[model samples]
Target chain A: MGRAILLDKVNIPGIRAFEVYREHGGYKPAGKALLGMTPAQVQQEVIKSGLRGRGGAGFPTGLKWSFLDRKSDKPRYLVCNADESEPGTFKDRYLMEKLPHLLIEGLILSSYALGVKTCYIYIRGEFKYLVGILETAIHEAKKNNYLGEKILGTDFSLEIYVHPGAGAYICGEETALLESLEGKRGNPRIKPPFPAYKGLYDCPTVVNNVETLATVTSIISMGGDAYSKLGIGKSTGTKLMSACGNINKPGVYEIEMGLPVEDFIYSEEYCGGIKNDRMLKAVIPGGSSVPILPADLILNTAKGQPRLLTYESLAEGEFISGSMLGSGGFIVFDENACIVRNTWNLTRFYRHESCGQCSPCREGTGWMEKILYRIEHGQGRMSDIDLLVRIAKNIEGNTICPLGDAAAWPVASAIRHFRKEFEEHIK
Target chain B: MLKVTIDNILIEVEEGTTILQAARMIGGKVVPPAMCYYTSLKGSGGKCRSCLVKVAKGSAKDPRPIPKLVASCSTPVQDGMVVENTISAEVQEARKGVVEFLLINHPLDCPVCDQAGECDLQDLSYGFGMEETNTREPRREYPVVDIGPLIKLHMNRCIHCYRCVLAAEQLTKKRAHGMLYRGDTIEISTFIRTAIDSDFSGNMIDVCPVGALTDRSFRFKSRVWFLNPMDAHRECSHCSGKVAAWMFGNEIYRITGRKDTFGELEEFICNECRFEKKDISDWVIEGPRKIKRQSVISGNHYEQMKKGSIIHPIEGTTEPQE
Candidate 1:
């Protein structure tokens, strides 16, 4: 409805095929990138595009590319993180399922820009059906000479492989994904040897999210400055939001960044308001890992601003009164939804998915889950609330990976905004 | 060389040294206690969050402090780095929380456990743990099993340090055990509970920080406090044979790797020296091993009562010549 780039040709029948996708102008970006511009020039255009990672972190993709260890003799890599296991997020699956060639085209363009001879799409094991679709797309692209040796008759050569993760949520984490790709137990590595310097097989690697890499094709298709002008401020270009949970129109929607939260929810083009015309209770604007915002905070800032779906606007007040536009897993909750039970449910997922690497995440997550279960089952004390807070605080920053903080943030923010709900359960 | 400050004590250490190593250079109370990190073991630290320290100033170039407390055991030092350990209230509170997490599922059976007096977890809990636990849930329980004929495994007391796993991996030709499952449910296992009959399997007991892995030959022989640990060695073809023979008078109670001030082995002894040869005639005794004065093993167990000293008051104290 609003400047659909990544999902522009998604609805076209047979777009999953390379020929149909080529008819719809797929892989043109790859041709434009490899046949004309140098890798640095491609990187500069990305830098100008001001595109942030569509992954929850929202790091500048261009800047992430700049940090790769190009000076090293070891071969570089581009690992696409398709393990979209974040609780409320499934937009990556939609993109790969409906528009597989778009992702492959984007990967080709991205791989060329980073000088990666080989690329891997590390999709989650659960997405086995989507893996078939992607492999088909890759096969088609290779047949058409869009991928494999000497792409589009250029001196540049490339190969793309599909690697499925063995169904672990932590494998969505870049390092854990790399470890899983290496045929080992998926445990995250300590930093200081970040993926940029030492990653898969001890080479400099760039692991971008599935949606992040897919969006690169659109940026290359439209000139970088033109793409940058579409979205407001730093949240440039369009975002593919997979809206779900009690929304009338629960599906992925591509809206330009800076769209008002209210319009995105209530408009016929998007979520089409809450289901059953129910009262909006809250919204987890990002994936479940980000803070859950109450209805008032999700719709408007503390300063009474009409909140937009940009990274800065959503995080305007920084956890106190705002949240992040993480992965754009827009989940809408009506008044009947119990925050306490939902918090406990999400906590259970984190506790189960914890890689058991570091102490705080390993032990503290299970501890929090037990307390939450007690509180939810009506066997809690008033002290347990504060105890959960204390546990969450300790685990927030003291781990080898972001999973600790992810596990902590939901419980902490749920308690912060919905203490009365927990109290009611205790009562 | 890199200049780093820990708890306001400045020291110069070699480049690539960790904050914990730098703190060890200026020893005493300044060294943050490490439960999982063994200087000899590769890829062993960072799992246990006991040695977390705040980096107040990242380095001379980037003076901005790190937002989160980093594990001092793994984080390498930078030039003109400033670290805060004991001095930071936030660090103290975080450490108290870490101890709480470590103990929430750990069983309280120290009195019956063989590694009681020398357990690192015991010392850590005494220092940083709270007076009373806040957890209301039941602690995780696991049945005691034997990984080998000579090594006892108490999974409940295991803190999942991965030390023994590393020891088995690095010290032996083939590792028999490894960590299985994940989260709090994670356990060190030989999969189908097979016996680890490797000659170097005994080193796992030396590397264990808790009573999880105890020498089966020494179990319940005597409390470590009742016996004296004497530094001794024997000529063996398998290992260095340097060990501490815990003896009661002339009777050998147990034989173990000679531990240092930090409770790490001076040299990993062989199983033959540790479990097989326990007789007094097997090795030449090198007198009493110097135990830390603060340790319960050293309590009232004076190895030196010098002649004419106050300890021997019958000889009388000599007045200073005026």
Candidate 2:
């Protein structure tokens, strides 16, 4: 309802087709970026736009691009992170399935901005059907001269490849995604030598989320200043949220940043309130990895200010009484939902998805899941609560990757906010 | 050179030295227990979270303390960095929690396990684990795998440290075994029932921190504490022939890659020295008296050996000759 940049033309018939998509102003930004703007100018415009990453980390997109080891003689690469495996998040898949050109156009502009010769859209393996749609879109774009060699009569040449992951949640992680792209097991590498310094077969690589790349088209299309004026401070521009769980409508919605959480959940235009008109119990505003908040906290902050969808507003109080706007995976739970069971289910997912590279995540996730299962099934002891908290604390930061913290946050937050629900599950 | 403070003890080490290595270099109680880090092998640490330490002040290159407790094994020492390991109560508790998670599904079959005497997990649990666990749920169990005639794998005992997998990949270059399944159900398995069958396959048993992979040749042969390990070597075409002969009475029960005082293998010996060479006649045995004081398994054995508890009647044998 509020300036839909990403899904504006999604409902159009045959928008996935090249002719229809181009007619709807698909490749204009690619041409403008290629023929008119220098790569440095394009990158500077993005920087001035204040566009943060749509990825869960919310890193500033331009700063990440600037961190590339440009001085190195190694060829630069840009990877589009389309491996959207986060639970309660399906927005990236919708963009790829419906309007693949939007993403392709964005990829071209970004590749040009970074001066990358080769780019890859690393999609989730489970999205096999979507891959066909993307492949066709790429073929059509190449046929139409939007992609491939000497685009728009410019000296710049670019090639895009669609690489599919073999079903791994950890592949959503940039380092692990790079490892998978290199035909290795999806295990995250150690930091300090970040992806910017050394990535993608040990060459400097810029890995952006699918939504982050798609949003670049909007930045170039509307001019960076105009796009920068669309959202709140720091969290600039529109965002695509995958709204799900206990709501009347559960699907992807693109809303300009600074939208009120209350309206997004209860208003008829968005989620249309909880299912069966039941009272809201809690909400996981971000993906399953983020901290879950009770209804009061999700609607308003600890200071009782109305919570907005922006990254700054959602994470106002840190993890104690607040949660993150991670990947915009807005999950609403009605009063009937059990926090213990939900937490257990998420823990199980993390335990299953752990790449088994780090011991804290590999062993701790399994331990937490078992403990959570015991508590969820009326076989828990009171001490198990403290034990669970202790385990989650240990795993929070002591891992080779953020997967450890991802698996830990939900459990810790559930216990922090919903200790009573956990107690009720015990015998 | 980079100067780092571990437990308030100042030391200077070359750049790129990990905090774990620096602490080991200082050589005191400050040596943080590293469950998965094999110093002899490259790219072996970062899996186990046991070696976490707090850096109050970061190095000169990056002055910001990396907001979280970092794995000391993978984190390089920076100039003028301040790291706290056992000195910090928080780090101790976190390590204790890691040890508990490792032991939760470990089956605690230490009494019957062959790697009980020198198991890193056992020593780490004793040093850092809680008195008891709170979970009443059943511990996970796995079917024992006999990958070949040389090794017996108790998969349930594996902590997923990946040391054996690295040994297979780095030392053997065969990569015969890999983790299969996922999450808590993850287990180390081979593609088929193919024998691990590599020149350095026996190193997997030696590198295992738990009793997951035991040498079939030495299975139930004798407790490692009862065997007197003597330094010995043979000239071989395969590799550096340095090895240790574990002798029970006058007969050698098994042979393994000789470890330094720090318990790192002197060299990764081949399967021939590990499995085929069991006789005392395989190499000239060094005198037990001449063996370094650190070569004994524990301080108790060190004192007894110094007091001449078991006198060697022959030059290479511990038992008296008739």
Local distance difference test values of all predictions, in order: 0.89, 0.87
TM-score of chain A of each: 0.99, 0.99
List candidate 1 stretches off by more than 4 Å: B303-322
Q: Output candidate 2 Cα RMSD.
A: 2.5
Q: What DockQ do the predictions score, one after another?
A: 0.74, 0.66
Model 2 DockQ reads 0.66
Model 1 DockQ (Cα-based): 0.74
lDDT (tens digit, per residue) of candidate 1 on B220-303: 888888777777788899998888888776678788888888878778877888888978889877767777888887675444
- In model 2, which runs have C-alpha deviations exceeding 4 angstroms? B289-296, B304-310, B313-322
lDDT of 2 at B18: 91
Q: What is the Cα-based lDDT of residue B313 in candidate 2? A: 37
Task: State the weakest 10-residue window (summed lDDT) of model 2 chain B.
Answer: B287-296
lDDT of 2 by residue, B220-287 (tens): 98888777776778988898888888776568888888776556777889989888988777876763
Q: Please, what are the lDDT tens digits per residue for candidate 1 over residues A1-427?
A: 3887788787789888777888878788888888899988888888999999998999999999999999999999999999999988999999899988888988888888899998999989999998889989889888989888888898778888999888899998899999999988899888878999999999999999988888888888997899899889999998989899999999999999999999999999999999999999999999999999999998889999999999999999998888899999998899999999999999999999999888889899999999999999989999999999999999989888999999999989999999999999999
